[model samples]
Target: MDTQIVRCRECPLQGCDTFRPLSEDKLEYLESFKQGEAVFRKGEMIMSQGGKAPHLHTVLSGMLIRYRSLDDGRRQIVNFMFPGDLLGLQGAFDDDLSHSVEALIDARLCVFPRNDFHRLMGAHPRLGYDLVWLAAKEETALEGHLVSVGQRTARERVTYLAVWLLDRALATGVADDSNRLELPITQAQIADMLGLSLVHTNRTLKSLREEGLVDWAPGNLSVPDMDKACKFAQYTQIDSKRPFI
Candidate 1:
């Protein structure tokens, strides 16, 4: 496979309003600091829990999942990372990765050596601000996920997740004006995310389909009516601007 060269100024996601573009000098400096790009196949581990995090990554394409495993071998997915999401920042601060990141599909990443990443942030205050903003956004997503898993019913949990993914896809410019979106995850992964068993997850999805709230195929999930799906999930839609890092 040929490696696709990633240039900061020519990034396809630069059009995302949430991501502020770096100045010419900063962009050039970042380009100099970049080591290269790495590609991973679906189901491959991008970064492992407890492993050395030598570099920070910017997701250039494809989806990823951040997760942690319990001593008993149960895994809880913490979040789904789309394009423009930053990875290994936590390790940049703590010197090791606390959770693992896996590619949900074939993925590509722009890599920056950890030391150079710190230098870039320090020398460019605007970039530093962007990093902080990204971190806060991630924190907010975690809080929402916690509430969904802890307090929501199985059906509601699934509904909210579907809506959330669709919204995210739209915000990131991956999907068009259509309500349909492709979700490549399995029911088992959804069960892991919602803290439910595989059987229960299947049943809840069936209920949603029966109610005309959603349509789920093997690798695609679509909401026929976004408003109705939100109502079924008891979700109040929030239109927050997302940053592209």
Candidate 2:
């Protein structure tokens, strides 16, 4: 397969929790990737639901959408990849991908061929632990998405997604002082992920914007105060399943 060359500096996740961090020694290894690498492409099956788990993929920049398609060809996007997120992890134990992964935009990535990745993890136990922690977090996020789709009201759905994005941005250290974050996704894509129609998604966004809870514009979103916005959605970071630490 043909791979695109990209500069390591172009990737936003140079020292994120996902991939092995770039120490001085690692820097040389990462610089090998140039800027604007294809990483992966849309419509190409990066991993199958039951495919072999070989090599791991790391997003340096851009986005990837994970989705499952029905027999009739309708696709439902399950998760969106951000900088530093790992792809092709579902088959860590077996062959075949758990879901399909495709690039939502031009992406840069560094790949650890399965054997080398395993060796790297073996040599760096912390990296191994981090990978496990990441997988657990992904599982939790999936559950949250399920709840957002199945139980949350339409207004709540909008809140759920908004707050989710806000929190994710904060985690990645990209949130601004205004607590506003810029997301360049379209309403149609949002609808597909949330299992809602485009009309409903637009209406919900408009409501939030009018209420002063959020500011929405073309390719940008600003939440003046996340505390106030979360309250509007009845949002809490607390996980209900376990006792408070």
Candidate 3:
């Protein structure tokens, strides 16, 4: 744990643009309630499935993958969590983690003990509303993922995932101005997320590359035109104002 005080108002990653700004009093209260910071190396588990969820984590930097494994050890990635995302809220309500969260890159997080967070929310209705708003956004994303896996073709699935990820990266300032986003997950992991075989996922990616829709090399992915990309994926943009927490 890093003990250096991290003031909420001074946080760079979860900016006011990405999340609703807290009032000065609310900020001070959160700063005091925050336990500290914790760092996770790439591939390290931040929260394990079925484990006690004692805290909620605010991503200060880097990326994380949320996944669940079956009885036979097959894993499906539920979502990619970026900077400004909140983690462990489900656990805060349920007492146990339903999925595991692992660092996709070297990451830092602000840790808030769940009990204190609950108390703060109880006292601050406005803050509590923000939390619900965050949960609803997460639910919308998950619903989209469910639709992708259940009805889309392999090529469309791949394209949809790519475009979706790029949009998030851009919104969160993870991507450079050139529209290039870092994708550190392996093809095998992607296959799991898309519900396809490894070979099928590779072929789909190759087709996407040949069509000039996307470029993937090493650890980076670039989308040349988001409009075209979304068209190929049959993506319909959801219109809603997102609240930042």
Candidate 4:
């Protein structure tokens, strides 16, 4: 694998308005601090739970899934990663990872050494704030997911998930103008994320599809009227720029 470093100024993530703009010197420091880019193919594990892959990453392209598994092989998906989302944050200084991150498609990441995190923070305080902001945002997203699983009906839960993923993909520039995306996640994975049985998940998705609310094929997900679907799911469609790393 090539270890050639990607210049921060040339980063695709840097070009996205969703991310906060970096100062020239801070960008320079970032360009210097990064070791390189890492590529992980579809279904490839970037880091496993309990393994020490001591690095932080910013998604440059593609998507990833973070999950935790039990001894009996039951899995619970924690979150999905899109462009500009930071990875390996929760366990920055810990020896073992608390969860595993796997690529849902061919994904690229801007890699930085874990040991230099504090040095980078001490030198640039705002960057440290951005990191904390990212972590807090992730926590809030998880809270939303918990509410979905605990309170929502199966149809409501699945509808909200599709609309939410579509919104995120659109914000990150991964979705096409027609609101179609190569989502690449399986219904089984969705079941894991939503705490549903595979049969129930399939039925809910089929119902949604029949109503023109969603079309969730194996590697694709789309809605005929994205705006209407968002309204149905009660997802606030943001036209404003959002903050990111």
- C-alpha lDDT values of all predictions: 0.82, 0.64, 0.82, 0.83
- Decoy 2 TM-score against native: 0.74
Considering every candidate listed, which one attains the maximal lDDT? 4
Q: lDDT by residue for model 1 over 11-33, one digit each (tens)?
A: 77777754555668877877787
Ranking by lDDT: 4, 1, 3, 2
lDDT of 4 by residue, 81-138 (tens): 8988898875577768878999999998888888778897899888888888888878
CA RMSD, predictions in order: 2.0, 5.7, 1.8, 1.6
Error of 2 at 202 (Å): 2.4
Candidate 4 wrongly placed segments (more than 4 Å):
238-245
Model 3 lDDT per residue over 53-94, tens place: 888888888889999999899999999998778898988876
lDDT of 3: 0.82
Residue 7, model 3: Cα distance from true site in angstroms: 1.3
Please list the residue runs of candidate 1 whose C-alpha ends up more than 4 Å from where it truly belongs after superposition: 1-3, 234-240
Q: What C-alpha lDDT does candidate 4 achieve relative to the native structure?
A: 0.83
By how many angstroms RMSD does model 1 differ from the true structure?
Answer: 2.0
TM-score of each: 0.92, 0.74, 0.93, 0.94
Clashes of each: 0, 15, 1, 0
- Give me the displacement of residue 227 in model 2, in angstroms: 1.2
Clashing pairs in 3: 19-244
Q: How much is the lDDT of residue 200 in candidate 3?
A: 93
Sliding window of 10 residues with minimal summed lDDT for model 4: 236-245
- Across 140-200, the per-residue lDDT of candidate 2 in tens digits comes to 8888888888988777777777777776656554554456776666888788888999999
